[model samples]
Target: MSKYKCIIFDCDGVLVDSEPTSIQVLVDIANAYGANIDLDYGMKHFKGSFFVACKQMIADLTQRELPDDLEAIYRVRSFEAFEKKMEAVDGVRDVIGNLNLPFCVASSGPESKIKLNLGLAGLLPFFKGKIFSCYALKKWKPDPAVFLWAAKTMGFKPEECLVVEDSLSGVRAAKAGGFDVFGYTAHDPENELQTLATKTFSKMDDLLALINNEMA
Candidate 1:
C-alpha cells in the first residue's frame, strides 16, 4: 500500500556505514592542510557535499591553497579505510532483501567510489547496474539533478519515488526533485532533518514497515 513505485537510496549512510570513515579521512587531510576541523565539522559540512564545494570550503577555512592531489589523497585514504571496516548499515540488508518494490542507489560520489563502497560492504550485488552517481552529470545533491535522473531512469516520475537520505543536502535534493523523502536519522545528530523530511526513522529495521505505511 505504499504510494511509491521506486525507492532511491542514498548510499553512504543509508546503504553502507561509510560517513564516519570517510569524514575521518577528510578531517585528517584537512588538518594537514592547516584547517582545524574535527570529525563533527566534517560531518556537518563535508558529509553530503561534492568535491568542488568541499575544496572551496577547505580553502576558505585554511586560507591556504590546497594541493592539486587533495582529492586523490582523500580517496586513497578513505578507500583503504573502507576496505578494512566498511559494513552495511545495521538491518539494512533485511530491509533491502524484503522490499517488494524496485530500488536503486543514487549517491554524491563518483560511480567508481559508489561501486567500491557497496562492494566492500557486500551490498553491491543488489545494486549492480542500478547505481546512479552525481559525478556522471557533475551535479551533486542540493542540486536534485541526480535524484531526478534516478527516478527518470527507473521509469518513475519524481512523485512516484521515495528517497531515503541521511544528510541535509540529500534531503534538500529529494524534496526539490518532487519526491517524498524518508530521513534516516542515526546520522542526523542536530535534528536538522526532523523538520525537513516527509518522514523520519532512526533504525533501518523500521524502514520496511514505514515504507508500506504499516508501522505501528
Candidate 2:
C-alpha cells in the first residue's frame, strides 16, 4: 500500500514550468512602475508568494505605493506570458499517470490563474475538481491553513498526504500542516528548498521513484 493516501502538488514550479515566466512578468511590472528589480531578485524574494505579497514587497523595495491597478496589470501580463511560454514540467505527466494514489493541486495562486496555466499546459484534466486555491481559502502559504484544508477536503489526514512543492514557502506550509514534503530543486539554483523538504529531487522520475520506494 502507498504510504500516502493522497499527493498534493503546488501548481507553479512543480507541475508546470511557470515560475520563471511568472517571475519575469513580476519583474517587468515592477520595473514599469519604477522599481529597480530584476528577475533574480524577484525569484529570490517572491517565488512562492501571491499577488498580495508581491505588491507589498515591491512597495517596500521601491518605497512607494503601487498603483491601485497593479494587481490587475500583473494578472494580464502574467496570463499573456503563460499563454506564450507555459509548459508542463518535463515528465510530470508520466509520473502523474503512473501514480495509483489520488492527487490534487493546492496553490497560492487564485483559482483563475491556476486554471489558466494548467489548461494552457494541458495538465488541467489531471486535476479538474481537485484544484484548491488560497483565494478560496483566504489563507496563503507559510500559513499552513491552505494545505491543511486540502488534506481535510480530500478525505486524508495531514500525515496521510504528501506534498510535492518547488518553493520554500510551499514546503514550509506543508511541513507546518503536518505533511511530508518532497521539494523540487530543478529551478532553484540556490538550494533553498532542500533544507525545508523531507526529501528533494531534481527530476520527476526521481520523485516517482522516491514515492514508489516509500510505498514499497
lDDT score of model 1? 0.92
Model 2 over residues 1-216: C-alpha lDDT tens digits? Answer: 668889999999989999999999898878876888788898899999988988998888778877888888888988888988889999999999989998999999999999998999899999989999999978998889888988888999999999999988999999988999999999789899877899999988787789877863
The parts of candidate 2 lying over 4 Å away from their true place are none
Q: After superposition, how far is residue 102 of candidate 2 from its true place, in Å?
A: 0.5
Q: Which residue segments of model 1 deviate by more than 4 Å?
A: 214-216
lDDT of each: 0.92, 0.89
* Clashing pairs for predicted structure model 2, backbone only: none
Q: Going through the candidates in order, what is the number of backbone clashes in each?
A: 0, 0
